[model samples]
Target: MKLDLIEPNAHYDMAHGKPAVLEYDNDGSWLYRLNIEPEMGIPEGQQEETQIGWKCYEVRGYNKATKENVKKVVIRSVIDETAEFDLVNSYNKHVLGIAVNESAVEEYKEYLQFTEDLDAVLIEDLSN
Candidate 1:
């Protein structure tokens, strides 16, 4: 029920004022890619837009000691009293910007299906 999310190795594109970046390991290994977004909440007055903000989000990465990627959305580490389900908030870019453990991707997919209002989820291939 409760899963832990991994943070990325590093970030970039922080020059002026851009969305915070979550970098990944580039050692030519298999890494799970996930395209995620918030369930819904475009605000009542704002016109529908395509981009997402970077204020709230999380990425799952390995801790080095284990050298394993975290493929599932962390079920814990959430304490929002008003949220419908436990979640890892992240920008729902039109891209697969988040990475998880290769094995946990499926588990994350299954878990996401049960949750409503979330943005469309996409799983990326490691070979790519």
Candidate 2:
């Protein structure tokens, strides 16, 4: 999956340079984080690392269970052509219940909004 690092909400501002945030509702859900790095490789006869060709996008999420942080999803690539389609399909499949007219708390509404916004951006990026 090609994952893009995005500031989905004002809370992201508090993350400083690190793109990290508790999944919008802040109900001790998953903490989403992004890491961008140059794909590096050592050239023959060279002792230094060099950028191979592409920038790697790593999307990671962690959940706090008890007192330990449990790793959740860790997507390694976010630039694949099919990423957007796959994401939308998966989201629809998994969150269809919530996406419908379901009663939810205010915090859950905020979380839905965040997901919607993120989806919009991903769709936009795909179109471009």
**Clash number for each model:** 12, 3
Q: Say which candidate scores most in TM-score.
A: 2
> Highest lDDT among the candidates is held by which one?
2
Give a tens-digit lDDT track for model 1, residues 1-128.
Answer: 22224333322222423332233557532233233222333645787753332223454555431212333332222333334232332222212556434445444455565332122222222323
* Model 2: per-residue Cα lDDT over 1-128, one tens digit each: 12344322222221243333323335545544333334468867999987543332334343442111322133222223365454455456546663543323343444446456555544443233
CA lDDT, every model vs. true structure: 0.34, 0.39
State, as a TM-score between 0 and 1, how close model 1 is to the true structure. Answer: 0.24
